[model samples]
Target chain A: MEENNENMTFENSSLAENTAVTAAAVENTENLNAAVENAPDTNAAMENSSAGSPAETDEEQKKPYRKIPKGLLWRCWFIFCFFQRTCQCFDRAYCNAFTYGIMPILRYLYKGREDEDEQIHAGLMRTRNYYLCEQSFSTVVFAIIIGMEEQKANGADISDELIMATKTSIMGPLSGLGDAIHGSTFRQIAIALTIPYCLEGSIVGALLMLIGMNITPWLTTLIGFPQGYKLGSEFVLKLLQSGKMQKAASAAGLMSMFIMGGMAAKYANITLSLTFKNDYKEIKIQDMLDNAIPGLLTIGAVFGFYGLIQKKVSTNKLILGTMAIGIALSACHAMGY
Target chain B: MSSTGITLLVAFILACYYGFYSTYPFMILMGPAGMGSIIGLIIGLIMGDPVKGIEVGALIQTMYMGVVGYGGVLPVDQFFACIIAIPLAISSGMSNESALALAAGFGALGVMIDTLWKTINTSVWTPYIDRACEKNQYRKIAKGAGLYPILTRMAISVPIITVLLFLGSTAVNWLMDNLPEWLQVGFNNMGTILPAMGFAMFVSYIGKKELIPFFIIGFYVMKFASLPIIGMAIFGAFIAWLVAKTDKSSDTEGGLA
Candidate 1:
């Protein structure tokens, strides 16, 4: 399973035109495209919308580019690229995509201002906004684009090992950081700060929510790029240098503190465990004991589910479990049990 | 009081005061059982072109959705931002599309206008939070650095979003309305669904399949049980800890933590 996943991952990560030695490279981008393109509801979008300029894609490599080793497969790349690029797609999709998506909208709104040209380096600002929205989870996107550049730099031979290694090894860690920083920490924390007002049905609340939501990720995404790229390059070089992944995971763990801490502050939830032996009785466990049980219960639920939760559990079920345990036991009166 | 400050305050008040009354988002999601979303693009283009603005709102919900507040420490201070922003946009002529987008930003912008309000808040409040975090260095940093940046962000954001919505929306509308036929179609198509797609991506990415139970628990608490999301969150955490304790002693240390 590990080997299969590794090979599959490597093949999925590789973006160069396909070659001879490792031809059946298990490209998953096509599957990913099919999953997205054939998404239950959102099919039949404009062909143009789902693809970039087809005219520009004619690089004319005779060798096929499939998981298959030998016969030419430009058609597959064309189809996926057409849909994926046109679709403006990505992985670790939510937080990164959200940041990427919003930057452009704000830029679009602001750039249209007649005096936007006068607003603090408009061209650079516009470029920043454009890149942010279009390329929020841009680690892979940029890597793929950079891989193309590497093709130019290294005489375009398509080193399967190098390409596969870079894509598989680098993508998970890069995206993990990407996911943690942008999605979990910055976006979650900021939005956590922001949403109460919007739900409250007040303009002030919405504004607070919006600013809290947008600016953090916007800033994080901007900062994340150089950090991720540098990290990726350094990680590969270090592996090359020492031939070990321990340092890489250690580095990632260190970076995770800031990200996870922020996530803890924002997304972490506690189930309140305040039940009265008798409601009429004036003595309350909370007022008397200062809610220690409830507090402990909160810590228990958050950290307990922490492992299961982080590995990508359905948020819906997590929430439901919280409520079931909350109400069921609150009625039963479990004091941080 | 100088008229400039008063004028700014009133405009801020007018723009954002309605957020307190806007229950539409809560109502929308709180209703449907399955994963449901407000059709932001339809709202944006149909209303104005605040595609980005609406996504901003969606992100706010998702980001905080996972927050588990133990004891009584409420993590976020800007819950009031969205309530303020949405209504102001609509009342001040922001279409539903644009209004939803600009609404949250406007709320924070409103808060920004009244620096006096925040200063009074932070000064009276900061010491308590500061003292609470003495045991943990991270909490200390959180109190000193983390909380205030967001507050300052809100302070500075009011006028910025206000101008963006009331004035900027017009320009955005013009561009969308006036673009060359094919280009306009392209922009409109991309503009509308792209934000929604972005939002769904966030959910799918972070909302992993295994954790569905927790999310469902949260939803259950929020929905059927009628417990406060905070209360349920705490209870959930407690049970999770007990579960962890049981899982431990006999097994390797691996749970939510």
Candidate 2:
């Protein structure tokens, strides 16, 4: 039994080494294609390369074992994509670390080899470093990217230590970017756009916001998986530095601001009911303000809240303050003052 | 069926489903069902009054808009609040503004229950998952990861929601009948003021000085033109796209220099 175990280990290492060489070759060709595709005048070359790649054809014929089955790919996608916030215990030691970051790769790697208990245990431990981070918009996107790279390296010569290290290093920056763009900007825009519709009791607005918020993460998983598997983390860094992410975020931010302004005017209902009994006519404060500057009170209320926030007032405090002021004013109005 | 009975039945089901979905499993459905607007729509359908249901839902939703559970700290329990307050309000003939106030107050209290749930989950179920992984029982690990947390959540949430629904309607009716008019008016005022707070929270999250002008533009357009909110949003999108185009061109020029 001992001799047989040794022989198995030897065979596995050699197979992995051979697979690594093939992966490197595939990576090089892909990088060249990507570079050409990015240039302005290489549209035709890009089309030709995509349509019929010599390297791809050679890889398909020679390295059949390297190809992940379609069913398995989809199953992996489903597990990692939806189970993003699983395992969020108090410690958060693996904060979606297992379900989102590691489980998909484990499933793909251990597909037909589930009997290898030792290998499974080893894989779990190796992937089980501190994986806690904020739940940003890109959380799932980064998880898919990292999981795909692990799947790509399953039979290759990459060490478990190296894979673990790569995951830890990338999560911080990716989450930061995602938080700024997806969490804060995109989500706000979705809310701003949909709130009006929701206020008017339109289900269409709710559906549109749900779809709009999900599209990016959905597309990221679909596209990031294959690309990460083929080119690894290099692709992720390049994608970030390309400036497209920033541009998209800025556009969304600008749009969100505009919609919020409109939302304030339409929804933030504040009117002065105070009227003065003069000799000739009773003067209504709200109507006069409206005639002078439409939405004056709404704008003022928004700025007032903004000023409180700038003064470092907590959200709870601000909520209570608004409520107190509103009630006080309403009571005064009720007295017909 | 009596209004209270109908409310109890619907609230119980919504609570059970919400507890399960909020955790690990069935997250896809959670998105739409989780929102106050959708919950209101569902309540409306159950009560055979979609219009009033929607109005109440929209009012309640604005209070909790842009609020999310980040880093395991649930600021408010929107699900619990909606389940308890919506049904009771609808059944008791409470005004939408009063319903909003009730829901917001319940949402704040529900935060404690949420914390307790998370604490139990961390201490009890998580260790089981760790042990299962160590034994290399992948199927057990899967169950521990997904099923256990959900069951635990439902166990706590279902009974509490059931009790709330059964008793909540009567309680609301009593309060409405006996409460002083001044306090009632205060609660109604909260319905209007709470949305302002929600908008303020959103601004604090994403506001930048450079973007303040766009907000003013949006406000005036809506106030003066009387265009629908959706129409204003489309116009905002166009302006954003134009701004992005110009910004990109300027960036390229700077790079060349």
Best prediction by TM-score: 2
lDDT of 1 by residue, A101-192 (tens): 22222233334445543431221121111121122334333334232222222223333333333333333433444445444444444443
Name the regions of candidate 1 deviating beyond 4 angstroms: A1-169, A192-282, A291-294, A300-316, A322-337, B1-257
lDDT of 2 by residue, A47-136 (tens): 232333565666435434434566666665466435545445666544433543355556556666646566667776665455644443
Q: What would the per-residue lDDT of candidate 1 be over residues B95-141, giving only the tens digit for each residue?
A: 33333333323333433333443343345334433343332222332
Q: What is the TM-score of chain B in candidate 2?
A: 0.86
Question: Cα deviation of A245 in candidate 2 (Å)?
Answer: 2.4
Q: Candidate 2 iRMS, in Å?
A: 3.7
Interface root mean square deviation per prediction: 21.5, 3.7
lDDT of candidate 2? 0.62
Clashing pairs in 2: none
Task: Please give, for residues B23-121, the per-residue lDDT of candidate 2 as tens digits.
Answer: 634232335445676676676666665556666776666666556553345667777677677777778878887888888777766766667767775
